[model samples]
Target: MPVFADVDTGVDDAMALVYLLASSDANLVGIASTGGNVDVDQVCRNNLGLLELCGATAIPVSRGADQPLSAAMRTAEDTHGPAGLGYAELPLHQRELTGYDSAEAWVRAAHAMPGELIGLVTGPLTNLALAVRDEPNLPSLLRRLVIMGGSFDYRGNTTPVSEWNISVDPEAAAEVFDAWGRAADAKVIQQHQLPIVCGLNLTENIMLTPTLLSRLAAASGATTTAMSVLDSRGTRSTADNTLIRTLEDAMRFYFEFHFDQGEGFLAHLHDPLAAAVALDPSLVQTRAATVDVELTGTLTRGMTIADWSHRWGRESNAHVGVGVDPAAFFDRFIERVGPFARRLQADR
Candidate 1:
């Protein structure tokens, strides 16, 4: 699969990038850095650094909008740490971003690939919305689109009804969904399909526990030190494999954050699960709906509403994810990434 990802590179976003690199079938052509987990500048740095760390620096990284479309920018530094990688630190290699900005990058990638690109967005929809505005044909150009955002009949991580990515830029998300609705209604291309939306209702089930991390380290042939809640906060992994160590350090902070939130010591592998679904949509089962974002509700702003019953009387714009097998997802993750980490250690 030829993949182009737009992301605000936080801990789970980093895991998604690494997962793409590790997948044998994934050909990651480009990455667009957007603002959500942190500033777009920091997101770009994290993308470059992770690429360098994974020995996949040839993929182009592009800078996106500095803020959201119609709201003040908000960042989740507390959730993802100040630099957006939790306790993990990666050196940003001396690499230049793509000559064009992120929106242009999106247009160029889709044009160049021409029905061969799988588009994945795991951040605010600013870049994609801008690209849609500039190139109205973008929806038909991609082979498929998978988004890691929104909450379908589920409690939001950001608010009672709003998810983080949509809440960050409700206007952009609204535009994106509206554009897709128009495209679906138009039926411009014979191969056009509605975007697969991996909402929190399904993604929150893809949890990352300490036992899984230990299994991942063992698979990498690293000396595994199992993480425990009993350990002091900020305890870092001592895994010999560099990749395992980096991910463990990153996930530990995520675990503690979730624990403090009363969600137990498990981290939701949100973005990575989206990445996986991009490659294999059968990993999840989705329901078609007319998806739209709430922009002006006092208590429901940024909420993604799915008109599953066609009350809105519009074409279905999204295939909302409602079911998944977390165990199968974890099995796939460990199988692919563990050996990739071992190979990285060997190359070093």
Candidate 2:
């Protein structure tokens, strides 16, 4: 129930963090702000601001490296907005970050709660890779690890054959996968539960629509205003619930971005679905695979390769998500977050 989150604080990352906070079973122990959707400094700011918004300011947020392990850091401002919260504006909080760095945070959390921590990473693998390097036994320390990255047997969202997170730090991603494989080969893992990888292939299916957003608002017992594709691009939510209003504003930008990309007027709740899977792996059906990252391919760098047939002759490092029920996930999301938002509104 102790959840350790590493996030880039993108609009979807904010959703994931809020989902964890909303879940009754999740005790978010710490947050590691990594560089991806925005800079590390901005990520820390977003994390602090988000905690303040949810009135959960006690969570310790740590900062990670500003750049990737091997490549020049690239941010997705066009996708996540300039400040990484989309169109929503959270109040700037004066909360300071944790004393130690993110890698140390990971090690300390795992040590403090040995075999009881659930690790969820919704950004590039830079911080987690550094943590694994610092503590070689990190793979066995967590009860479960869920990563939101990569695409297996599916088209990529970054380059022609690369996903955003992995493409930003292919070397770090490769190192993390290799570390898990090494741990498995050494037979050090007790549960043999490989990291559940929520790749783009499966996550893209968890789309968010205006109707669902309205349903969430109504579930929160708020005065809801329905969002529509015919509305203005910068249309804001008129929900009575503050949390729902913020989410609606953020998701409006996301919806427009996806529509511009010809996807539709819907946004994929990629990181939130990953966060859900971390708490309940039964939400998704996974296949064991020796997952690796392509680092030097001419046109496929950062491509995630899943050896589902033992072609690599190595131990499986990841349980690649093969199938899921998007409706079930949405139901859980609304059921959990709606009441949480209602409570926050009542407190206000």
Candidate 3:
């Protein structure tokens, strides 16, 4: 089985968490939240609420960094709403807060596990960076690091060149990439231990299909009901309605808030696709490359530079996902999430 370490602060991040909770292949050790879409405190609360919603309250939730490594912290409230979860009012589930620091919890979890554990990062890399700095052996303890960040060839949703997660913490991202490079170069890490980046290029292929949304609507419990009511009241739009309309009208404006300059009926399910790739690598097309984070450029602060030129001819440290079989991936995702949806809906 695979143990998980999550760093999240997005609405979609909650969906990804729920998916992991439902998946049989994943054993959630602990969760660490970083400041991205909201404040660190809110992200922690959201993480706890998500676990309760998924009936995984036994899992521990910890708060992470409130700001980025260097630059001023930014948030995506315009897209994810004020409270995250699209302002949907979920019923409160009382949970006894854990006493462990989020980063410390991660280290402890790694130590407790018999072997390497997977680090599935769905948000900014701040917490992971802190963990690496605190515990130098953390990377070696990890079986793999599947990160949802960056953009290779596609235009970014945050900026013309920057993806949200990387844009939020470029300094931390640089550190993580460098560490992965060092470990891979030394051959101290297994082939699967290298970081697998599920960037916007691959995630853009996985759309929230109508059938899947219908399944989610049917699967979600009181949370879905509350969301539907909120959608009706115009507080937010349901994923089903937003996705269907985007596909139908070709406007594609459900999640795009930074740049309103796209013509195709496509929105990247960036975080969920990352989780899917972590669950099964066969869903994507991968190529090994020396992926670097651009931190000092005037216009490319968070751009992910995949060294595909083969000039230096260095051993590839990163597995960059270039493409995905959207049909096959979505089918598998629906198949896996479908039962959980039904069970959750029934529980409600």
User: lDDT per prediction?
Assistant: 0.93, 0.93, 0.71
Cα-based lDDT at residue 275, candidate 2: 98
Error (Å) of candidate 3 at residue 206 is 1.2
Q: For model 3, state the Cα shift of residue 50 in Å.
A: 1.3
TM-score of 3: 0.86
What's each prediction's TM-score? Answer: 0.99, 0.99, 0.86
| Model 2: lDDT to the true structure | 0.93
Per-residue C-alpha lDDT of model 2 across residues 1-348, encoded as one tens digit per residue:
999999999899999999999999999999999999989999999999999989999999999988899799999999988999888989768899989999999999999999999999999999999999999999999898999999999999999778999999999999999998898899987434478999999999999999899889988998967988899878878988889999998999999899999999999999999999999999999998899999999999999999988987988889999999999999999999999999999999
User: Which parts of model 1 have CA positions greater than 4 angstroms off?
Assistant: 189-192
- lDDT sort, best first: 1, 2, 3
Instruction: Score candidate 1 by TM-score against the native.
Output: 0.99
Runs in model 2 deviating more than 4 A are none
